[model samples]
Target: SPFPVHINRQQVVHISGECCHCLRLNNLGIFRIHCHGQRGLIEAKIFNLSVGNHYDIGQKISFQLLESYEQLRQFPLEIFRTSLTILLTAQLRLVQERIRDLIVEEKSGCAIVSFQLFEIAAQLPKNEQVINILRNLIDKQAINLIDPNRRILHAICGSLVIGPKGESIDVKLFSQANGDYIGEFTPKKIGQYRIDVTCANIPIQDSPFFTEVYDPLQVHIGPLPKNILIGIENTLEINLDNAGNVPLEVIITSPSGINVPIKIDDILTMKKVHFTPTETGIHYLNVKFGSDIVPGTPIQMMVNNAHIISAYGDGIHHAVHEKEATFMIETKDMQGDLQVDIEGANSVIKTTIDRINNSLLKVTYIPVEVGFINISIKWNEKDIMNSPFTAIVTNPGNIY
Candidate 1:
């Protein structure tokens, strides 16, 4: 019989057999079976543990019996205990050794897997990395941005004095191929510094950027007469010395704070602006110089649209100073008549005598081609006070 098969979890059963010849001989088999989940496995061995029989401690045994004996009744009780002890000892040793091996294998597997996954191949940081560095630069305040190409670097924070490992190292902020940023921070002092800049959100890592401070050059509109007498045109001369490479803007402001119209002559290198007073009062002159100008490059003389008298040379560096004559005209045409014209402070002809070139004077008739032009003048924003001068004109003489 198969031992009734009623045990669960773990069970041990013994099967004994005998032949009719030796009634006292008994053969025994021991089985240790276990069922876990829905699967079961069993370890079985047969042994003759009779006190008088030789039994090797480590030997394989079988369940087949050659003979049976009547004294085998005692065989069940003695052999049963002996087989149980041997099976328990062997199972315990095998399970303990296997559990330890599994633990060791699991730990070793994790270490090996990590080593394979995180190896650093020789490579550099990319554009994205560079962008991050720029962002950090702004946050740390290493530089300030006035415009796209203009920036100022902080003296102390911007330098890498000591190296990262306490050894002197070279530090540079550069752009990479992929646009990533890699920093070579040579830390002289063990401290943190910030880089700040003023610009739009877009980054300018690989672009052309320069760090230099520009100062504006000075210009003078020259001091004018404190009191501008009415009926006199006040003449003001403007002067500028190129303190910087960039050209500066020179503007003259009226007493009303409006920009006064003036004549600009761009001479050799200095730009000269001549202003005639329209009203009498203390006037303000405002001049602004651009910092982009090259140092010591002066804008000699610049001309405005107002009045043009005599412009000597091409308005290049060291051009001849210009001169304009403002005077009243008395025209005597071929018809022999005298006419007077008042020239005001306007940039154009203030007032021209109509048909004066054809007018008749005294008892003589003046032709349109013959006349005497008269001239007179007053200084500053004043009226024409002097008598007019004569401009002579002669008629055409036929040759052939």
Candidate 2:
């Protein structure tokens, strides 16, 4: 007698028997079996099963079959059962151990993320297919990409080309000859960017990678006056912006090749450098921020000659007709002989100049008129302080 049993197509079923012969009939989708020298019957029913496209990894597919036999002489019937299970999995594996984060400058052309891929089995699909799988996984948005500050959750994988300010950027994917994958994109703004990688819809180890972009430092140098006088203290102001919280180094060189001391006040915002030039020529000021020189640096200043300090006269304000008047002159850093001149209303008053000291000059003159008296003092043709001094000449009797 024959017993009916059902089994799933392509599922293996075990039939246990000693000295039993079994034959597969491909045309009828059944197995023919015979027991040695014994009257036996076999019946098999098979059902076709289709696999769904949404299958997950490690999912199990199983089927079972039951068989029963009745003895020819009315012996007790025997039953047997068999089952099989198949697990679904892919051959893709992440070969690279760790992925590092990236750092880029603002307006940088591109950012690249590199990784390696290898297969778990030797009989897996070709490398092209594996690459396609990776591409498809990325295209399907299986990986999460975002900018936390912007609060944006990327919807498309390739479309994750945005800067810190939500600006459009260009992105690209590369296939390397050494079995490595590279993802690249250009950043228009500056900030932190995060990228996550996944394989077979599962997050890869060290999945999220961080990238930081920053803007370069900007600097500006002095508003120095075109003409700077010698022997006078002058202030050089340097306006530094975007110093980026770093200490600034500044240097000033005089025309005599002497380094001038500089003082930086309000270092963070406005910086000031005060220097007093001794010699007269073009002076150079060099300013540095870290290892780079600031823009418009090495400023040139035209230093002119020295000027007078003070000048006075004795008895010149109310000079007598026949009395002698003495005039004194003081200059800053003047060392040469001084030339003195005195002129009356109609005649030139004769005067004698005496170098009392290195920076001092004395002149003695006799007033011959009752009008205004003009005294001129010079050192190397340059006027001393108040060189053209005026003195009133009144009557000797009316003088106080």
Name the candidate that leads on TM-score. 2
The window of 10 residues in a row where model 1 has the poorest summed lDDT is 110-119
Model 1 CA lDDT for position 194: 19
Which residue ranges in model 1 land beyond 4 Å of their true spot?
1-206, 210-242, 291-383, 389-400
lDDT for model 1 comes to 0.28
> For residues 177-208, what per-residue lDDT tens digits would candidate 2 score against the true structure?
54333444443333333343333222333333
Alpha-carbon TM-score of each model against the true structure: 0.23, 0.29
Clashes of each: 92, 1
- The alpha-carbon deviation from the true structure for residue 199 of candidate 1, after best TM-score superposition, in angstroms, is 18
Cα lDDT for residue 115, model 1? 7
Model 1 lDDT tens row, 363-392: 112223223333332222222233332333
lDDT for each of the candidates?
0.28, 0.45
